[model samples]
Target chain A: MDRGKISKWLKYPEKMGHKYSLWAIYFATGCGIMEIPPVLTSRWDAERFGVLPAATPRQANLFLITGYVSVKTLRPIVRTYELMREPKYTVGFGSCPINGGMYWDSYNTIKRVDKYIPIDGWIAGCMPRPESIFIAVTKLWMMIDKGAATGYIRYRENYRYYRENQERILGKLDWPPLYPEKMGEDNG
Target chain B: MDERELELFFGPQHMGMVGNFSITLKVRGDRVVEARANPGYLHRGFAKMMEYRVWIQNFPLVCRINVMDPDPYELIYAMGVEELAGIEVPERAKYIRTIVMELSRLASHLAWIWAYGNALGFDTIGQWSMGDRDYIIDLLEFLTGGRIYHIYIWPGGVRRDLPDGFEEKTLKILDTLEGHLPEYDDVFFNNRLFVTRARGVAKITKEEAIELGATGQVLRATGVKMDIRKLEPYAAYPYLDFEIPVREDGDSYSRMMLIREEMDQSISIIRQCFKKMPKGPVYHRVPNPFKWKVPKGETYVRMESARGELGLYMVSTGEDKPYRVHFRPPSLPHGILILEKLLKGASIADVGHIMMSLYIAAPEVDR
Candidate 1:
């Protein structure tokens, strides 16, 4: 009916091609394969935005750095970021990604997700409201349209400051204590 | 033909996951051959951190363990130390604690509703649930400055006295929420799709659940009728009367229903607490936050959290800091061992759903 409508119809088939980007996501960086449902669901779906996971360093344009990252997780996070193609964007879902919202000072939780990966958006809640998540996606979309999606470059340039000397933003988080049973190895 | 297994790790950042945890799945064709949970992402060395901060500082810190229902942590720790130090909580302080605790319960269960809906791929349910949950958080923020982590309940008593007309405002909010319950049921709790997806999934018998260390809804869902509040009434719970909802089937569906019904019970408790609350000083006169030293003693206090029985084992050395603070988090048995066992033959899609229903707090587990 209109030029924009014609363009939308033309892009629909091409957009469908992005669903396969999930496998590329797996091949690109294997963070948590189990958490792929929300990443692939009908709503909050990653494929519709053309910002899907890439299999290798060359195929990826955007990195959906969803969920929390810790020291144990920091290794894969760093490796995956390193493997992504240039001019990529990183989005941290929930407060776990930024300032370790719920898990602040645990030996394992990285105080700030921005320590390892360059975050384009930091959703405030512990597990962010999906509306905030959708807002983040829109922000990322705007960044893409503006051709300024490379948070990785800025991260690399300021790497030393964020990595070595950044003050832990939310210091000494106030939370309930979680203590594992002492490792006695005395099971008979 | 090949002995070498292809290892596929899921989560620690994946979308289908409940939180920051990984599942190493060995998949042969479409079925999972073996699965193991790797949880350490949100670990913040809670016990170690507790050892560093003073007793009062730990009140705000402990609430972070399980962000959903934080009132229990503050209440239990304060009560435990108060018992050890022999401090008498004022009558008004006790009633205020009960009001706050029940409000925390309402918010916690509401958040659980969002997670449950999201897990089953029902996004609208999640949206509605979260919007409704925000009302509870709003009410909480009105009482306490912070939304998710309300560092309100302190040793001796609450942090501040009830704001002018706080009870009236809270009751009004509860009235609004009561009207919205049937709509939530239509969309989530009794939704046919959710009912189908959750029914019979992870079915455990009562005896099996007891042996598995299942507490809270997991125990109640199996028709166990076990609740820590009833068994050990700490803080102001001894004064409040409430019913523990139980279900015959211990499946994921039954557990979801049990939690939903529990929210109603929590609301009722809040209403009762408000009706009977006496007006007086909100906080008892305790030593200041920074330089306070607790008597040397070990107190094991357990409270019913949104998940289950959360036991805080505080070992004090009569110093400004705790000698050792060990948390017997309810989520561990369910999130780790219980989840691994139940997920053995289930589809990979249902993993996050089951975990959400279990309501694992990554910080709680890691601490």
Candidate 2:
């Protein structure tokens, strides 16, 4: 019971909507996806925490980067991340996403996930238990309350910097830019 | 006649498709005209990676091949190694492996039900099936330390013996699952809407199904009585008595029905394992991981996984690490050939429904 969030909840119902109804776009990457069914099912019951899988990225605010991101997968990942609405949060769900985990030396997989996507939190394990996902979600709620979970905002503010880094690896990205820096107009 | 052709990139991210893979669908109006599969998004090239790791280190890597049903991949890989090394799994270890495999089959079927129901816009059954699958995953967590990837089945035998009072707990979970069958029948299996949507949606002939290299439930549903468990007995399958559920409809409904009945069969098999299990050592220690070198030989071991026949082809050249490791996933033909052919005349609404009904675990395709 953080007093700040409690007070803010009363003041801003908008924040309450973001806190309670966090729709996660299940942008599955690798093996860690096995844990999601159990989490969403009756046993783990992630719905109890108001987290559900959104079919499309446009409707979701929480992007769950489930496992290792290979060089090829980062293209869709960035596109999906950009499609997500503002006040968004991203969580890297397994050890693979945090630091490439077992695939550290694998030529295709990216060793550091944070370099490309602005991840608000990480659940570290070869594959973290379903319960650990709940913990990450609660921490995300706290960050949202404090207005600290600003990965989306950060993505918008420094689109050029992030875009350059993304383009460094993924040359001539297929999709149009999420925010055009050349227009000199703040999309944020 | 007025319908226009639309080139749709039914890529990896869509709800209907399985895993991190894509399908390039050419559709005119609601029906698909031509389809091409774009796979390997989840491809870490695990086979090449296996060559670099030692025999024991590769055990965990095999499970990553099929995310939905990792047990059979681990089992087949272990069986391949066991055959290549001339290692014998003990009686108790074989029984334990059988029990774990059957439990995995149950969980995998439940997941298939969840996917199928969700694909057909029946979220109620999806939630229910997922709830039931969790019960099986809980038992898995109890047996192996890990929930998703057990990595328990190794060359010589299993990792360890069953934990204390594991049998009794397993019985209770089975009882609970048995109780939930009627509710599933009402909401999903026997539900009129599901039957209407699934039946005749993606029908395949028996000859083409076999010709196209489809196996497991997909092949079985096409009226072909082919099951690796029945035809080729491995592990404790010879001792255990279970019937393979086959349906002749060769449509989405038949496949769905076989999956439901197979879950019941898996449950029955687990009960049989519990009744017939014997007490003995679960493992026979091999030489140190680094020093253990398999004899020079090539072996092909195939096991019936949740989807179908999961085969592993291993080439060991008297080396500490395998020279070549190849996986024959049941989902390959089901995903690419069967799925693409099945999708050609299927309405756009049935794209995901038909694919889910086929039960192609996409990770296996890429791996």
Candidate 3:
């Protein structure tokens, strides 16, 4: 709606569309989910920022992993990531996913979430406030505008490394690889 | 024609499911023939981790056990450690703890209303209740410096005393919440759609509820007058006079109504705490955290959490760390045993509805 950004919007129409409407799939992994309702509801009203909760992963572009990812949950996290359509964004919402937060010492939780799945941004706090989500969203817009937020592209390029890291913890994921086993190859 | 049965997996991902929990259902047509709860997705192994941390260090770790209602875990842990160390909480601290716990209950019940409303296809009610719940979260943030994880209550006493004008702010928020109750009734509780959806669904008898270890609103809704606050009084509960609201019908509607009425009771209890609190220090300083050693003893402490009877059984072996720490979260029974039983013969659509009515926090079941 800003008159000044009209020229910029006209120049990069597809980028502007993706930047504005971010349908989020909030994967409630831990304690950080407590802040999500407030952010989505009337208090913070994430709709104003064009961030809304999508019903399913296939429908969503923004994947907000909203807490600590335990060993058991990591498989589902990986699966959900694979299921989402390309040009997707993933934001680790709390301190847990960044570096395991308080569950760093615990045996079950994975330390660094980036080892398993690519993260576009991280809003770091024990439990980040609802306002922090908005800040993350705006920052994501900037990243998308600059062509910097290419986590989906990164995942595709380095699928083997990410898959190997996931297998190290999860022990042989039941599903096959999203991309080919080898890069730049026709498997047929 | 032969009968056919199909296996269905309900969430850790589905929209209707609660948190990172799933249930395997055997369905014949729309009706569930058998249900099995699959928890442990949220388990951080708190019981195992507590063995490594010192007495005071465990305080912060315990609250994350139940995310929706964290205060009761704090209260129970503090009570367990206080019992083991034989530390007496000040009279003022007792009153403050009571007020904080009740406010937590109100916040949790409001959240339940939000979830319940949403599960039952009442998005308007969900938005209204969640918006209102933020005011209570703000008050908690002001008191404890954290919204979700308060980490306020400890072994000796609370982390801090009530700030100036705190009581007035709390009362004003309570007034606002109380005023909205009637509107909630109009849109949510008294609405014909809610009644039609909730009534006679997941109905349980008084004997069935008692037999299956169903506590909190589940038992109360079944006409059993059992409240840990009343039955085994803790903190300032003995001094305060509040009724345990009960209902004859053990259906989902009755359970929902019990939660609504208990919010009223929580408000009254908080008001009474403000009136009766005496002037004194909030905390009695304990020994140094690093060198502090609790005498060899084991104690079981239980309290009325927002969900149900949250009990902690702690064993100290004259060491800085606990020998073993066990939390008897009410959700363990409600989510697994009671939930599985209720799901049987239930329509596939009402699975989330019944689960929410039972107030099953998945973390509590696994933690």
Candidate 4:
């Protein structure tokens, strides 16, 4: 509202920019996708938090994996996660993504998403309320501020371990590497 | 000729598309020669998963089958169980079930409106529809605990009676929504630009619609009057009266018009339920849910969801768990078969619009 605000932004535009403008990809993997309409629209208005839906993974910094992740969907989830650039953040919405919620024993769905891809934060509910989504986004800003959201770093350092776990379930992966190869190991 | 045709995957992660489903389009220039819908991106193996859970446990799980309209699944499951178990629902509970079910329909149609606008690049209408849809969600929140998945409509009867002054609050919300309808008509529904863009964009003939197994708004928009509510009345619909909105054009515009009018009808149906509602307990006492078992029998029950005819077939061998379960969701024809047929010979620009207009939700297709 004032020049002071503009001056503060001018000094640390990168930090403020990353904090203020978090664009989540409009990708939904589960039933929790229903909560997204109210959050993004005029109802709960998640845009007031400077959050909006990006059309693709390449353009987005914030990723929300809503609800349960089935074995079939996990491949695309990993691909979508890899598509995001550095300084990216991920928020696993609903209890399904955290520990599979009611679908814990489901033959197809993944019990916990963290085993494959690192999750920065989790909102636990069968379907979290629209207001709770905004609170999660606010908390995400705090994580970004403190630099505690190192999911990307973790993904890089432990790519081998994550890839092995993924390969065990999704045998004989067809796609090529997301990150460049190392010298010692086979590219496969 | 085949060499000229390029294949592209219109992915699920797209903003203009509905749910986690994709379509592989074979296009030459800008016109699609063939289309194949790729589902299973959102499949949680719903029918397969349901067999493992006991009857009561399956109630909450079935709502996830169609996120946009969860009640009809719950209704069908409840009805199927009621049929097999020979549970007679109370009169007043039927009325309450009717009201809540129609409210779910209204909420879903609002969602359809948002999807249509989003597919056609009308952001303002999408926002307006979603914002308006929240009023119904708020009412649902007051009545049921959950906003998205109510799980309120259960076997034997509903989960709870109407809340204190709920009828008055519903009337107020309906009136407020009714007042805003004219403004909506001016901005998006009746706007010349929107009409011209959507009219005759994706046409489905009446004969083809029926042959292709199309129902709900898809068939209704094509001048066919086939509704499960009128044909086989369930819950309190037999006591209540409502008209099915139909348009003969069988195009995207007609479907949009029909959905808009249906919202008004849903409001009316809810009103009628309230007016004719007799005061009584909402739910009938039944055996313990965990221990509840049906006599060895097979039963099929159907209901009219926001999408269309939703049916559930349950088989029991005198056991608490279902021996077999199958869902006849409208999305199968509406999403995969009808979508592939409709996308042929259409411009790439109209692909998303046509799909959304058909109300092809991915979960229903995959499930």
Q: What is the C-alpha RMSD of each candidate to the true structure, in Å?
A: 9.6, 2.5, 1.9, 2.1
Tens digits of per-residue lDDT, candidate 4, B1-367, equal 3458899889877776778888999999999999998888776777777788888999888988888888888888989988998889999989988888888988998888888888877889889889989999889989998888889988889988888999999999999888888888998899998899999888999999999999999999999998999999998999887999999999999988988899889989999998999987777777898998878999888888888888888899999889899999998989988999989999999999999889887888887
Sort every candidate by DockQ, greatest first. Answer: 4, 3, 2, 1
Residues A90-158, model 1: lDDT tens digits: 766666666765456556666677765677766565445445645666676556545466677676565
lDDT of 2 by residue, B1-367 (tens): 6888899988677777557888888999878899887777877778888899999998878887787888888889889988998888899898999999999988888888887777777888877888888878889989998878889888888998899989999999999999998899998889889888888878999999989999988899988898888888998889988898889989999998998898888889989988898988988888897889999999998889998888888999998999999998888888888988898887777788878888888788877
Q: List clash counts for every candidate, in order.
A: 28, 0, 0, 0
Candidate 3 lDDT over B143-187, as tens digits, reads 999988899997778888999989999999999999999999999
Most accurate candidate by lDDT: 3
- By lDDT rank, best first, the candidates go 3, 4, 2, 1
lDDT of each: 0.69, 0.85, 0.90, 0.87
TM-score of chain A of each: 0.61, 0.91, 0.94, 0.91
Docking class of 3: medium
Worst lDDT window (10 residues) for model 4 chain B? B1-10
- Using Cα atoms, each model's DockQ against the true complex is 0.17, 0.59, 0.71, 0.72
Docking class of 4: medium
A17 Cα displacement, candidate 4 (Å)? 1.6
Per-residue error at A148 for model 1, in Å?
7.1
What interface RMSD, in Å and to 1 decimal, does model 2 have?
Answer: 1.6
**Higher-TM-score candidate among 1 and 2?**
2
